[model samples]
Target chain A: MRYAMVIDTLKCVGCSDCVVACQTENDVPHGYCRDWVTESVIGTYPEVEIELRSERCNHCDNTPCVRTCPTAASHVIEGGIVLVDRDLCIGCGACIESCPYDARYRHPEWGTVDKCTFCVHRVHKGQDPACVSVCPTNCMYFGDIDDANSEVSKLIAVRKYKTLAPEAGTKPQIYYLI
Target chain B: MIPFQISGSEEVFISGRNIPHIDPHLTLWEFPISLYLFLGGLSAGILFFSAVVHLINKEDEFKGAAKWAPIVVPFALSIGLLALVYDLGNPFYSWRLYTTIRLESPMSWGAWVLLIVTPLSILWVMTYIRELFPVIKYENYKMPFLYKVEELAVKYKKYMALALLPLTIILGIYTGILLSAFNARPLWNNAILGPLFLVSGLSTAAATIILFAKSHHERQWFSKIDILLIVIEIGLIIHLIMGYYAGNEMQIEALDVLMNGEFTTMFFGLLVVLGLLVPLILEVFELAGFKVPVIIPAILILIGGLIFRILMVEAGQLSRILY
Candidate 1:
């Protein structure tokens, strides 16, 4: 299945629910968050609008992270989720360095790098990721793009969507609706 | 926008080191550690090439086959690894690099390659260990693995040379590719980096091999190799620096960091002087029919190569663009 996520910037309140949800689920190392919020602001306070974009690993299909991996530790999983094998990782941080988005983190205990995996564990258990479940704004959506009946696929079909860093050619899984 | 604490107008953090009021958005790991990898790989590559030439080609025709090939391989490989480990933040964890495989990372690939090549190389040199030290042979019997490798090298000398050629190229190219893989760092993002590294590897490897061989005949063969390698290196450096100058604003800024910033001293002083100039001088002496021995030039060349790696890695990292 071609798993995908679409984040609606207008609906996001920048409450950081996604960050907390991600941290709890992944046991992310302190001083590092798998999912975070980016804000772009313009003009004075009276006229200003803080544009918030929730960011995480795009899980690109043509990942440079995969290309730079010497031991084949970081890879794309069966369901199109890019995963890092903690067992095989040597904590060399090459993948982390290669990642343009700053999505990856070096786990304190694992010693290897970790990043958003599109909630691969939850998918295996037939459940939604904690962040999707916890997002009160319903700004985040995830489903198989192959299943046209799925809400995510239908929404993507009907709306104009964008992915981060198109020049990178990773074919990012995360779609942003403008 | 979320507030970012900047102590200066454009201060940046590069590889955990803070550069105040510098290029605030660039982050690169062009460190001593990274440079050592490049040098070490080059050293290994040169030895591989030299050994191949010695093993496959008619040694009777070559001037310094017996003395130089045997001496250069082990010494360069051994010292190269020493420089590598010494540059690491935690050298002990280096062993753990072998316990796992991460094909996505060039350093991990390099680590594995080094592991395989180091021991194989050591064994290859041990073929002449008896000649180097006759008493050591009588002290201990040979291990089965070492004996088997010796047999393999002798039996499939041509095949080994062919096999080693590609591996050496890969080992050399991977050094530049390792840094190039990081697109976030504009200085390392150039396509020419791989070729630049390949040339640097060949030149440095030549310097290292020349440094260790002591005899006159050995010096002649090594000087010949050095001349060819150094010319290629100079050409590549010109291309790389020129490309940096001709590229976009970011590339030029990065280049400025090398030419005029913190790395200026090392780049102009150590890498240019020790790595390029002195070695070139030694080569000229050889070309002019002077009677310089192999030891001094060989030592100077090796020192120059080491300094070059240090300069490249440090100079390349002086600019910071990412916070």
Candidate 2:
């Protein structure tokens, strides 16, 4: 089963409720983040188009980070959830350089590469990911993308969507519906 | 838990897994990685030249390089290893780098090469110590272990040189591969980097030998070799620039930094003109039987070689796709 997160950009108001919830649930240290919102202003002021994108690790099938890591500390699990084994990480920062999305960060306290795990621990208990549950608009969907009956797969089948850096050939699991 | 203010300029202090989505112009893998690349290339390049000289030149009339290559390569490699170790800073988890070998990882390939080459190069130098300095033989007494090591080195020099050739090539080219494997960095993803760094390594090693040559004939031979490698390096560099200019949008963005951005001075003035081109011209003149002193070009090439490595490392980090 390939788990994925599908985000509906049109429904998001950028209130950052999910961002706050993620922090509280993960107990992440300050001055670092596993997910972030990027703001972009396209076109001139009169005809301006503003976009807010929330991004985290894509959990790619062909990750440059996984390929370049000296140790196998960065690995993909059964559902294609990329996780860092902090016990094995040497904090060499090679994976930081290899990530095109700039998704991962060094944990301020532990000095190990850290990123979103899609709340895997909570998922095993049959709970929604922290960010998805906290999103007030209910714009984010998380489920097995491979399961045609899943909400995430259904949302992706009909929505006009896009993904970042397709040229990178990483085949990200995250999808953004515009 | 500071929220994103409407306007932004400062970095945020994120509380959890989330931060504002933006790729800051962050530079990763700094001084230690650069030092490792430069020293690794030099060490491997010197050993490669040493092996070639040992095979071709039967008479050891002027064998300073043959003796120095094995001794100096390992010394340079050890410093690079130290730099890498310090960069890691987590000795506890660093051992994992050796326990698992990922074939696709350039860093894994590099680690194994270093572990093998360090001792092998030392052995290569050991075989020749008696020839370089006969004092060990002239001394009245010698330790049995020391004598045994010396005998093994002399006995196995030919086989070791043959064995060391392929490994030396890997050591020289591995630095470029290491950088290029980071597909996120546009400037470093070029295939030309492998050959470019290899030629650069060879030229730098040639310059080093020229500096240390005890006889005029040895100096002239190494100088001639340097001229060839330098010329090839110029062509490869130009190819790199042209390839970038003709590449896709993000790739061109990387070139724009080296071409016209803040790095222009260091890229054009320091690395291109002074570091590489000046040395090339000086060596050309000397090759034509001009009266230029060997040390002048040798020193310039060495300085240029080091600066070239530093600029590549910094510039590649500067050229990020996300930023």
Candidate 3:
């Protein structure tokens, strides 16, 4: 029941619908975001190639955030969902420093570190993440990658995809197909 | 037509003019964390100096700092602990840190280590209470419990030394390992940080003793040790920088920040000159039969130790894979 996400880079248009949906669903603060878009442009003068990526917590198998957490506040739950027990969080920001992706942000009001939960609240209820559901281009895929017949598993089986910061060796759940 | 060649490379190819300015600043662990690292090392430094002086019994001057060392440990450590709690998002619930332990996490080991170190330091200090504070002397006839406790403490004093040396050493290295565990920051990812910080902590702690030393001989002895520690520290700093520079492009960029980026003035000027080298030169002069105020070099070393923590914290935060 390990959940994961696969984002199709070629299909995305940098519309940021996923960003808005994530914010509204999570009640993310005005200045902070649960997930955000990154734009990388290459080439000089008229010959230009641009890539836009939607980034968030990788929920890695070898999670540095969980390992670096002084309190067991950041823990991996049953479904490989990395969660922060806000009630227990001391908010030392060690997890923030340890993350290569810079995914987690200190919750200003909540006084704890916060990040994308993959809409775990919705997933348990048999629904898609707010970002995946609201993505206008249907570029975001969310499913149980462990299930051989799942759409995410099929996508991985069929296409060549890459995860962010592989050098980190975190084995990120999110995949990007360029 | 892009030159992008690898997957998950530590670079983003940008040939366009719209490359957003990378902020020269970013930090997650702020003032409190840096102070904790500094004070923690200082506490360990004091403990190490006191223990060594106690073992050697060569100079009564060092005995002065040994008298204060036990008392200083709880005082400085309490402040450090307070800073840690204050930095927490949930200070009230920080006891949850003790609920479980993760060996892989230096933070968890650090917490537990401090927890045990407090009581052990108190017990060690109890053994020296008669010598350190004659006003509170315990008569065997009047206070049998105090006499019994003192007897046991004196009896097991050698064991106490064994316990404290490793604990203080661990305490010193723990501060460095805490940051080194964060593999994301190339600046802190160096393996030499443990030794580097240990030397910094010891040298600074040595300076603290020399500051309070009443006799010239006592000041001279620790000053000699300080000169050696300072030299080792300089070597470690060079090694730390070279490790980053010799790394990949991302690592090289991180080293550039430490070398000549926004941290240039602080790293090279305050940390290198005023903090380390000045004190080293002065101490060398003092050691070579030259008369110089011992307090000046001692003050400089202490300031340098503090700046080392602040600059290390800031520079590591500034060097990141993403923002």
DockQ values for all predictions? 0.19, 0.45, 0.46
User: What interface RMSD do all candidates show, one decimal each?
Assistant: 7.5, 5.0, 5.9
Measured with C-alpha atoms, the lDDT of residue A62 in candidate 2 is: 84
Q: Which pairs clash in the backbone of model 3?
A: A90-B89
Q: For model 2, what is the error of residue B196's alpha carbon versus the real structure, in angstroms, after optimal superposition? A: 0.7
Please give, for residues A75-141, the per-residue lDDT of candidate 1 as tens digits.
Answer: 8878788898876665556676667666776665655677888788887898888889899999999
Cα lDDT tens digits for candidate 3, A45-150: 4776777788789889889899899888899987798999998888888898898877787887777889889899998899999999999999999999889999
Question: What is the lDDT, from 0 to 100, of the residue B159 in candidate 3?
Answer: 76
lDDT for residue B256 in candidate 3, whole number 0-100: 73
Q: Evaluated with lDDT, which candidate comes out highest?
A: 3
Quote the chain B TM-score of every prediction.
Answer: 0.76, 0.88, 0.86
Model 1 clash number: 21
User: Residue-wise lDDT of candidate 2 within B1-323, one digit each (tens)?
Assistant: 34222222222322234333233444656787888888888888888888877887733644757765456777788898888887773655777888989888899988988889998877877776677777666246645577777788778888888877999899899989888888998999999998898888888888888877778888888888888898899999999999998998778878877888878898789777877788778878877888887788788887878888888888887786642
- Top candidate on TM-score is 2
List, residue by residue over B1-323, the lDDT tens digit for candidate 3. 23222233322422222212211233767778888888899888887777776776643656646765556778788889999989887678788889988888898899999998876676677877777667875664587587788778778876777778889999999999998888888788778888888899998888888876767877888899899999999999988877776788778877877787888898989889998999999999988889898889999998888888988888888776542
Worst 10 residues of 3 chain B by lDDT: B15-24
Is model 2 an incorrect, acceptable, medium or high docking prediction? Answer: acceptable
Score chain B of candidate 2 by TM-score: 0.88
Please write out the lDDT profile of model 1 over residues B210-272, one tens digit for every residue.
654445565567678777777777787778789989876656777876788777777777677
Cα RMSD (Å) per model?
5.7, 3.7, 4.6
Q: How accurate locally, in lDDT, is each candidate?
A: 0.66, 0.80, 0.81
